[model samples]
Target: MKRLARALFASVFLSVMLAALLSLAPVLSKHGSGSLPVFRVEQPMHLTEGTLVDFLSRQSMNMRLHHVEWERNSLTLDLSTTRLTNERYREMYLLIQRTLTQTDNVESVRLTVYDASPATPAPLMTVRATRGDLRKSPAVQQESERSYQQYLERFFEVKRY
Candidate 1:
């Protein structure tokens, strides 16, 4: 009777362990199989109008930019997203790069997409500065702001008779 009870207890424990392992399988697979490199904004990207929030939502698949760390000439962004496919991730990366490149404070936008696997840890993209790239000088920043204001004024097309 004692031996039988011990066997039954051991069987119950094994079943419970198996159940737990099975439940965790999907989560582990996702984490291991499709992990992607996260992007970081390395400068204070003074967004024009509502573009900043819009950009983040679209790029990170509605994930909010939780934290921002500012350095001397750079800013690091902590962004979160649910789960993105390779194509979606690439599209988001390009969109950010394009937007940043359009800004004066952004000298260059580098996108480093991490591999989906640990053995192949490499960035998928590395955008470099193009020629005639506006330097992040104070004058350039001021000029850019002035230009944006002027553009907005023109865009509104308010007439003075």
Candidate 2:
């Protein structure tokens, strides 16, 4: 009876340990082997236009400008962040579009994601959608996601230190 109980306990312990490790695999794998810090987005939808400028200011210390303006009838949200990864950039971009487009009199939205890193040469990604485009938002998002995957496939490398 004692041996059976010990075996059961060991199996349960091993299973729990394996589960814990599996859960951490995604988080560990995403952050480049734990060498670099990761910024976890906490409730990105709560970000307001007022907070948008200030939040980005603190988030992108080296960024020269974070601006939002009216262009024609559409609202343009332009922000440059050196610290945010391409994946995070897409997320925040989509989040901002959803948040702003749903509020008040926004007819169309344009989000420009800029890589403001001094090391990086000039390159920017833009996503534009009108109220009509909301129906196709999922398709737009999928294209962006596919682009990110292709980017990772081309550039992602595993390094051991």
Candidate 3:
């Protein structure tokens, strides 16, 4: 009788452990690799708009994509980046504009940035420019993001930084 009871308890324990492991398999498959999984059926793009959004959102935990509107060759991005200093806002804006303008599908880009840290949804800034404008700067379309932001304020600014 005692041996039968011990065997039954061992079987139940093994069954529960197996059940728990099976339950976690799907989640572990998605996240256990320390990076997000890719399950796309489309052709691979190292940096398309989706990846761009991911990169921007990951820059700071507070920054997020609020909305998006796509026209024929123009793209509009609405971002909620909690109260940012002038430098930070410029950094994000240029990063977004420069990379997006390089893509084939995007001829122009518009960004409407909102400050989400305030109690009343404070300041908002909107800038819209085309690939031609982005490329016609002092760098002649050949500057790193840091250097590019320096001299193209006219082409890229809607108001203050």
Candidate 4:
């Protein structure tokens, strides 16, 4: 009876240790430097999110992008700020369109910016553009105009002077 109990206890302890090690393996590689993850090819969404975050952090215009989601052929970025400006919108839209449109995997990109001004409820402004539309000159300009209009409508609410 003693021998059987000892064997059982040893096996259980070993199994638990092995399970813990296996679970922690993936997390161990994520905490290091700016070095690109070796497993990026297997997970395209992670690759995209990491790249965008790095790019935004390096840019002059401050952007607080809270969430990034990749669904099917689309990537969505959720950005929030106390205030937003015209130049910020232009910079973000151009950067995303220029960078992601060239990639083979993504077809559409949507940027959802939330205005977190203190007086009123947060207003949302979404701008969506396809890869083909971004590639065309007229379509790109149109999309930019539309995005700017949407931003003005949502936050500024341009009243006729």
Candidate 5:
């Protein structure tokens, strides 16, 4: 009889612990930098969320667009990526810039990238470009790849968190 009572007590204790942990999940998730919750808001422009998602996914199988914060004339895109390379970021930026419409409400684009593989997550890097700067930067068709890359290197700032 005593053995059975002890077994029941142990199970009950474990159940209570599990319930407490489950309740704290949301609190923990909110504090974590690695995993982010996507907010659902009305998209600002015709540029479309699906287009950006598709473009980024096509660029790398490991990267994903976590969220987008749309402003009147600028867009802040949060991307979770395991692939970390300057060339890769530039290539993706070029692809993204090419897709933006000149007449749209979005004049500037900022990519706030987080390290997907980090255990204690912080922002990995940020890449931003304005439409006017894009026009003044090296032309894709007319200029050599080196010139375009140099332009990207000069204008696109990278800061590690």
Candidate 6:
């Protein structure tokens, strides 16, 4: 009876230890720098939410919308796509610039899209948009506010001025 109990205890202990070691294998084998490199967007342009999301979806890309500030007329999106070719990535940036330029509400668009794929190896894209200065003219302000209000009504349920 003693011998059997000892053997069972030994087997259980060994199994537990083996499981623990296997679980920690990833942590132990990780030798490279754990930090990811940051890439800056070269030239950013203004863009609309609809246009941005449409382009991404058309390309079958994934993205996360981080922050949207209508007052500042800016938005920040994180590119979550993994299959972007270098050329395609550049093309996307150009598309954004062109689209923003075409939009009536965008006063000036500047972008600095970049990727940090070589380290931590994840692709990221960021966009920032600024609305044109309509404060100078009451008519322009009213028109812009109306358009912005329409956008809000279409996309959000919250009441906004």
| Per-prediction TM-score to the true structure, in the order listed | 0.29, 0.39, 0.49, 0.48, 0.53, 0.28
Worst 10 residues of 2 by lDDT: 152-161
Please give, for residues 65-142, the per-residue lDDT of candidate 4 as tens digits: 777787786777776667667766666656465545445677777777777666653646666666665555354444
Q: Pick the TM-score winner.
A: 5
List where candidate 1 sits over 4 angstroms from the true fold.
1-61, 108-161
Better of 1 and 4 by lDDT: 4
Arranged by lDDT with the best first, the candidates are 5, 3, 4, 2, 1, 6
Better of 1 and 3 by TM-score: 3
Of the candidates numbered 2 and 3, which has the greater lDDT value?
A: 3
State which candidate has the highest lDDT.
5
Q: Write the per-residue lDDT of candidate 6 for residues 1-161, one digit (tens) a residue.
A: 99999999999999999999999877765656574336743454334565655543443323322323332344334343444454444454443444444444555333333344355534343333334322222342344544433432232222211
Give all candidates' CA lDDT scores: 0.45, 0.54, 0.62, 0.61, 0.65, 0.43
Candidate 2 has an lDDT of 0.54
Model 3 CA deviation exceeding 4 Å by range: 1-62, 119-123, 140-152
Query: What is residue 142's positional error in candidate 3, in angstroms?
Result: 9.7
Error of 3 at 105 (Å): 1.8
TM-score of 5: 0.53
Tens digit of per-residue lDDT, candidate 2, span 64-151: 4456776445666665666556565445444444544534455666656567776753436555556654544354445654654343
In the predicted model 5, the residue pairs found to clash are none
Stretches of candidate 6 off by over 4 Å are 32-71, 74-161
What digit string (tens of lDDT, one per residue) describes model 3 on residues 1-161? Answer: 99999999999999999999999998987776775457744442244556556544544433567787766766677777666555555565565555454355567777777788877654467767777776665453444454433443556656544
Worst 10 residues of 5 by lDDT: 53-62
Per-prediction tally of clashes: 4, 0, 0, 0, 0, 10
Q: Which 10 consecutive positions of candidate 3 have the poorest summed lDDT?
A: 40-49
